[model samples]
Target chain A: MAFVVGMLIKTAAVPIVVAVVVTWLLHRLERLKPHAATLGVACGFIAGWFFQEFSVWFPVRYLDWFPAAALILALLPRVSPITAAWLLVPAFPKMVPPRLWAVGLLTVSTYGLAWFLNKATDKIQQRVIVGVFMATGTACSLVLLQSFSLKFAQIAGLLTASLTAALLSANKPYGNAKGLPFLFIGLMCNLMFIGYANTSSDVPTWCFALPLVAPLVLLWNPGSKKLQAVRYALVVTILMVAVIPALLVHPPWEAEH
Target chain B: MSRNILIICAMALLLTGCNSEEATNPSPDAGDNTTPETSSGSGFAVTSENTKVLFVGTKKSGDSQAGGFKEVSGTIGVDGDKITSVNVVIQVDSLFSDQDKLTGHLKNEDFFSVKEFPELTFASSKVEGSGEVTITGELNMHGQTGEISFPATVSVTDGNVKLDAKFKVDRTKFGMNYTGQPDNPINAEVDIEILVNAE
Candidate 1:
């Protein structure tokens, strides 16, 4: 029991609890039914603030991406793509000097990918996109825990991914509308990882790109509908293959020793 | 819909405002210094060249690592051999650990967050004793301030005053609670030694 409690604290149970409560509340609001992505963003922002105000270990700037990404998703459906893309402009100045060019490249690439994913035709494509988002979020969380010894970031990532998954699951028959939230989260998570990589030592360059690229394996499209589950497993397996080794190379528990 | 977005934007701005001021560009000289006339009369400038503030923290394996500030400046007020007041400012950015990686990590958010809080300061509220010294003061660090007391040995020779002290401080008291790992954790209590020279 003592070890379990220790693990819970290490995993940042407090913030996760707050996030779950907030997400549940937002889900219950009848008025918010059409704006679930916006609700997720708001909840993410609150969770981030809760973490910071309480002096939890997650970097506040990185946590801020949750709301920022949600806002982008919320606006994508309401305005022109060009207008919605402007939402990320405020964060550019905070990037490290050497990372500015990379940020620009990432922004353009993510924007293009999000735009393309927004037009995904079938349920299988949408599911793949969602799976990709889930994998990236989990991978980044693990990376934070293993590479930088950032337990708070790891917990925050887990909470955000779980909340996103719950939200997506509850609102099934997703169709084309599902891509927006997944794309937003995927892009933001990737950006956060990149920003972290720029400042951190011992993080390999491949760790930065693997999550974003791993989802592309799903683009090959299995020939039959019956094989969709196998394809999903394959994509996740590839992502794990890419991410787990990186974590093994630099375990957070062994870092200080 | 627009109203909700506007509210969120406003909240974001408010949250941004709560961030601490950047620690990179600390004021070159921001602490109280006794004026030349004051020093000539009843006080002495604490010379940075001869003063040292060192700290030893225990790692998970119970081994100790010592680090210290390369720069510190302060003043000591005295009236006829009776110490009156003390003021000290330590540059957090000047902290150096045994290893370069540890030094960088200490400066980052995990330990000092020097980018957000660049200076640690102490100002004495009361000073007592003669041969031995007891200083009750406020120590400010990591955007938090708290009172602390430590005993010291004081000596005056050749028109110069010197103080030596050793004490333990809880890092969590100053909001630095980055204790790592459950099985092998960084010790919360850090041993600190202070040496001050004033002439």
Candidate 2:
């Protein structure tokens, strides 16, 4: 009973309330309006703080603090959001041999995805489409990450909530990532870390990469709002069908608590 | 100087690989079949049947949950009927609770987080007195090591030894500060009971 209540508060109530409030506040300032999408990172920071200890010394154990650090990197006016990608450095999972090349590839890929997502969302309407897509990706992340780490999953939950509320209230708050050109890059960083942390899941590797194809939806420039919604549903449905369904079939005992 | 730094970074890159299947199998620290040693290596190995380690956690509303670790391996160092040292290693993944879901939740970050830090260890830093003994040691849990002192009873025979103790630990001190809800909060004080028999 206590566990259920704690999870509800940590993963549900606090995340939705914090994300919505932050989105509403950011929307109030004209200057900060453009950066409203960074709310996903902000909520992720909150969830991470609540879920994991900031005082620990181990490398991967320090991940709960990464969201806050990444948020700082993204929100700092003097720095590039791409700098948040450096989180991949501290995020090196000790359970494996250090893969420097893999880290480099992931960092570069995140930057590329950020750039591509930005270009895809240049228009206001396109921003909403990508925004919804980012939310969907976050929802997928919450599910997949739960199979291994709840801290990351809760972080994913906050991002999903923040994106959803931001999408509704601000029209297009999933506008940009922490300090970068795209929000999905931050989500990708989270998904990548979860993948590294995942050692017990039966879910295949490629399924983890399914949501990175958000830009593929941008390829079809829909002529009307109705068609765009259709495409959005089609894309998210396919991604959900591809990932969440198979993973849900697992009995609860198999999941890492 | 910059070139040397780059070389070092390159070297670091070569040394580390991506995470794999190591976490699936939880184990003690590599090469840590730690048997508490003395002049004669009097550390007696006890079977699970003869040993018991248990904990009871409560809610602010007064509800309680009890659990124990399934796999426990440790040694009680004895030097000629005098207890010298105590070492214990608990596999976090082996945690079991009265409720199955709570077992999983306890293993998650809200409690044990067995995925990252897989073992809880303790090594005696100070052992004082005899009979009714005060055992002071570093109790390492959830990656935070804290010096904890508890009282226990120690008895020794020719080839058999028995030790028993009960104590309280603040979960918050070990970094487990999950307050359940506004109405039903988790109590910080957790009751720990240990019984060790070696023959």
Candidate 3:
């Protein structure tokens, strides 16, 4: 009971509070509006601490570094040149697992998606952007909890929670979440990459790839508020109708009674 | 504002602790990654089939669960009638519990974290006594090293050696900090049984 409570406080309660506070503070400071979208990333960073890492932050333990990297990389972009963020790129994937060089592509993909999503979704619906990430996050956490490391699942959960709280707290609508896409992609990629690399369960390789393609559900936009619900319904439908059955192919380990 | 800054800094520090070893680029097979020293005559290879390394963890609910490692490899060296040195390596991934789910959970970060550490090793520094013997050495697990001394029974016959020992290792000592559920807390001390047959 205490363990569950502590986890709730650390991963859920603390992160929600931090996200709300950071988003609120940044919203109040007129000059800081451009920095508000980065709120979720920062909240995730603070939450990372309460959830102590599996091992000490040994150089190899960068598996737990996704949240921290998102905030740090997005820090200067709100105030300075975007190119400055590139310097932090080399830090991730000293070795994500299995292959040394190929995992670097995963790192590259994170930055690439961040740039693409930022540009593509700038004018898109806020409901669409947050919805896509939240849906993908839900699937990632579920898969990770069932098949991969639980910490990775919890990591995914906090990323989604912090981002949701921060994005919604900002008073301004779509414009408030500056650099939102970068933090979203980095944090998501971190957990998914960790899940894919280290999962000892029987989940098929293709099933793990499902979350990456989840964002594509947004492509079929109805362009109306009433139809915004379609995006989530489709994602859940694909995950449930397709994913859950596949995941069930290899039932997760269950506790003994 | 300064207080907020302090809170943030403290959180960051917790993630990246102080006094961390340099990215020393240590070899993949670094810590205690050697067989018994060859300088002390011939080394006895551990008969993989004859060796056993098992552990028993008890929960507060009085439901005691048992598990063991499947792959245990080591060498026992002997000089005359006395055992000179011992090196044992346990592959964490090979750990199996009573239930399949428990096996998977044991491999997660809450337990062995096989992906991160992979192996538990013990290399003896000193061996004392003949019939009722004691071994002292460093036990490395979860990236932390602690010296341990345990009593054992050893018999070196010709070129073969048979060893058996039962000891309790505090899991917390190795940084395995999971306390189980509050209602059914697991004991911190876990029973470890070791049996090695070398011929």
Candidate number achieving the greatest TM-score relative to the actual structure: 3
Off by over 4 Å in 3: A1-10, A51-60, A76-99, A170-173, A224-229, A241-257, B1-34, B38-42
Query: Per-residue CA lDDT of candidate 3, range B132-180, in tens?
Result: 7999998988767889989999988886788999999998998787775
DockQ of all predictions against the true structure, Cα-based = 0.09, 0.13, 0.18
Per-residue lDDT for B1-199 in model 1, tens only? 4673555455445534565323222332344443223333366676569799999999778887889998888777776666767788887878987765566567655677554466788888888997698999988887678899999888765568888999988998887777765676789899999888777
**Clash pairs detected, candidate 1:** none
lDDT score of residue A109 within candidate 3: 60
What is the Å distance of residue B25 in model 2 from its true position?
21
Best by lDDT: 3
Give model 1 RMSD, 1 decimal: 7.3
Indicate the docking level reached by candidate 1: incorrect
- A1-257: candidate 3 lDDT, tens digit per residue: 24543663466666666776777777778887766657654665556545554534433445434444655656743221122222222222133433423334444566556656666565666656776777777777777766635576667777777766644753433557777766777656655656655656766766666676666566555777678677668767766643685457546433342
Q: Which ten residues in a row have the lowest lDDT in candidate 1 chain A?
A: A80-89
Q: Quick one: ranking by DockQ, best first?
A: 3, 2, 1
- Which candidate achieves the best DockQ against the true structure? 3
Model 3 complex DockQ against the native: 0.18
